[model samples]
Structures are given as C-alpha cells and as structure tokens.
Target: MYYIHLEGVPMQCVLVWLWHIVRSLTSIEKILLRDRPQTLYDLSSKGTVPVLQLADGSVIDESVDIMKWALKRNDPEHWYKENFDHQDGLVNKNDEIFKKRLDRYKYHVRFPERSYQDHRADVSEILNEYNSLLEPGPYMFGKDICFTDIALMPFVRQCAHVDLEWFNSSFPELGAWLDRLKESELFISIMVKYPIWNESESGQYVTWE
Candidate 1:
C-alpha cells in the first residue's frame, strides 16, 4: 500500500509515478498530515506519508528507496543501465540541494529573515544548472526517459509551481522539459485521486492488473 497527501507532496507523487512506470500492483491510501491516521502512526510514527507497506509486512519509508525497490523488481525501461552512479548522483543532488532550496522558497514565511527572491534565485541556479545538463534533450539523458528523469520531474514541477510566470520566462528549456512530463499519460495515470483515508476504516485498495 501507498500513503499519500494530495497537496504538493513531491515524494509521494514521485513514488506513485514510479509504480505506474514499473506496472506494480499496489493499493494507495490518501492522507492529510494535519489529520494523520493511527494506522500510519502504527507503521512509523515519526515517518511521513508515501510509506510502502510490502505484503511481507516490511515497510519502505524513503521515497528514493521505494523507487529503487520498484525498479529492481522489474526494470522494463532498463533504467538500471550503465553509469548508474551518475544517474543516482543527479537524484541525490535533487533531494539534497534542490529540494532544500524549494522548501525555503515555497514556505518562505517559516524563515522570515530570508527574502523570497533570495531563495528563488538559489533554486533558479539549480534549475539553470539542470537546463545546461538537459541541453541535449528531449529528455534528461539524451532521447529517452530514465530514472533521473522520473525521479527529478516531480520536484521540478513543484519549483515551477512556485511562480509559473518566472519559471516559464526565465527557464525556457527547463519549463519545456517539465511540460513534456506533465503532459505524459504516465504522469496523468498516477495522478488519479484516491479517497482520503478514514481512521476507523480498513481503507480502500488499488491493485495493479
């Protein structure tokens, strides 16, 4: 099963996207952080949503780890190809650096000392760097979709959402690249909303065929 929040939870969005890409059979539980269910707290009180509860009763809590687990089971796209370290490095940078800038920029009220433009500029540098990397693209790594593309797109989407006008005008290639992923059937498929979880119920399940 997958636990997700509807509003701008990039990790949850990415995990669901990866599952669709891998064609994995799984159920999903929608959750709101403000009203976290006991069932979720039972799994990992400290852990956030996007937890993947395996049938064996083990749980994968980290989003990237979940992506690796899903892909390892069946990499029909062969995303686990040569230069995997390089691909993983990109994902690491997105998680570590880009996401940090994103949070601060998006939730700038939490850090009143820093101006929104300062954080946005920091994130823009990261996007510009990615734009340079993606110059050879229709996708991130040459002509096809890869692990890095799938893993990073959701975060980029989040950043763009912060200011669509700035993102579109300032980062044209990056904007265009994101547009492709957003328009994809794969992205659209996983974005289907499930009912929000109720604490008293056993909850609904969404299994793959």
Candidate 2:
C-alpha cells in the first residue's frame, strides 16, 4: 500500500497499522496508491496529510479514513478482520480520548495548566490496561505483531519520549513495549529519518542511512 501523498507523507502513529499490514502481506498485486485525495482544499490550496490519488486518478484525503480504505482491500495483517469488531464504533473512542490526551502530553505547552506528569497520568491508565493484557506475551496479538499492536504504538512511542524516566517510573510495561518497538525493524523502517517531502537519493519510503 503505497500512500500516494504528494511530496511525501509524514510519519504518524496511525500510519503504523496500515504499514504493518502491508509489510506482512507483502502483496503488491495492485499499487495501492495513497495520496491526500484531491480535495476542495488541495484543489484550492495545500490540504492535509492523507491526500491520496489512485491509479485511475481517484483520491482520498483524510488520514484516519485512509487507513481504513487501505486496510479494507487487504487483510494480510488482519487489521480489518481481527480488529474490526468494535473498531468501527469504538476505535474512534480510543482515538478520541487517548489520542487527544497523548498529543497534549507530548506538547504540554498547549495545555499550559497541566504539568507533563498530569497529562501523562490521563493516558497512563489506558497504557496500564494494555500492560495487563500483555501478561504472558510480547505482541498485543499473541505471538506475532498485529494490527491492534501497531495501530496504537506510534503515539505511545512519542509519549515514551516525552519523559523517558517519568514514563518508565509511571508505566513500566507500556514503557517496555515502547522500548521493544524502538528496537524493532518496523520502527526503524517507519520512524527513521528520511526527507519528509522527498525520497532520499536511494529512493526509499524510509532511508535511515
């Protein structure tokens, strides 16, 4: 699934779900091009992150919706298959509640009154739930990595960085999971620095060289 966003696409937590699925499937039968779908805004001016353009010149703009669009076509990662039960109605809840808290925690200045710890506390409760789930495993979905695991990781990864010591002290299991993701090749491929607007000279989606 090549996210056909113009110039390039910025790396975010949401992209991880689609990324893991695409990598695991490794099926390039069709060039799933993702672009900031041609929009009234992009048509008039620069639009959002997920403007997608299809081979037939079709387009999709919103990022979160795009993840669903890409995932629906394939189930190699079972993103839609396994994670879709309450995903339609409930996925957005976590996205709404926890995601909002995460962003504020990462960039606490916007929420000026709240200390970083206070902001983290708001989200840590959710992470602790995940920690309990991981009682006897590494990946969120049993032995291997799954859509559920990757979907929520990027933001958590960002939070872990907000205060490594603090997050470690507060939520060790979630912190451990974040630590594991940092060391994983997937994290290296997706999070590694590359030109946000241009593929490196080697012309890769991610180039950490």
Question: What lDDT would each prediction earn against the true structure?
Answer: 0.74, 0.57
Model 2 residue runs over 4 Å out of place are 1-3, 6-9, 12-40, 43-46, 77-79, 86-90, 192-209
State the local distance difference test value for candidate 1: 0.74
Model 1 weakest 10-residue run by lDDT: 3-12
Measured by TM-score, how close is model 1 to the native structure? 0.88
What digit string (tens of lDDT, one per residue) describes model 1 on residues 1-209?
44332223454335434455343444556787787777776786665757767767877777888788777676776766756888889889988999898999999989889898889889988899888877887777778878888888888888899899989998888888899988887777666656776667555555565
Per-residue CA lDDT of model 2 for 1-209, tens digit only, reads 24344333344423543354443322111111343323324432545444555555556655566666666655564655664664443356567788888888878888989897788788787878777766668766556665566666766777677778877877776777778877887667654333333222222342112
Q: List TM-score per model, in order.
A: 0.88, 0.68
| Residue 145 error, candidate 2, Å | 1.5
Q: List the pairs of residues colliding in candidate 2.
A: 4-34, 4-35, 35-51, 35-52, 36-50, 36-51, 36-52, 37-51, 37-52, 37-60
Prediction 2 global C-alpha lDDT: 0.57
Off-target runs (Cα >4 Å) in candidate 1 are 1-25
Pick the TM-score winner: 1
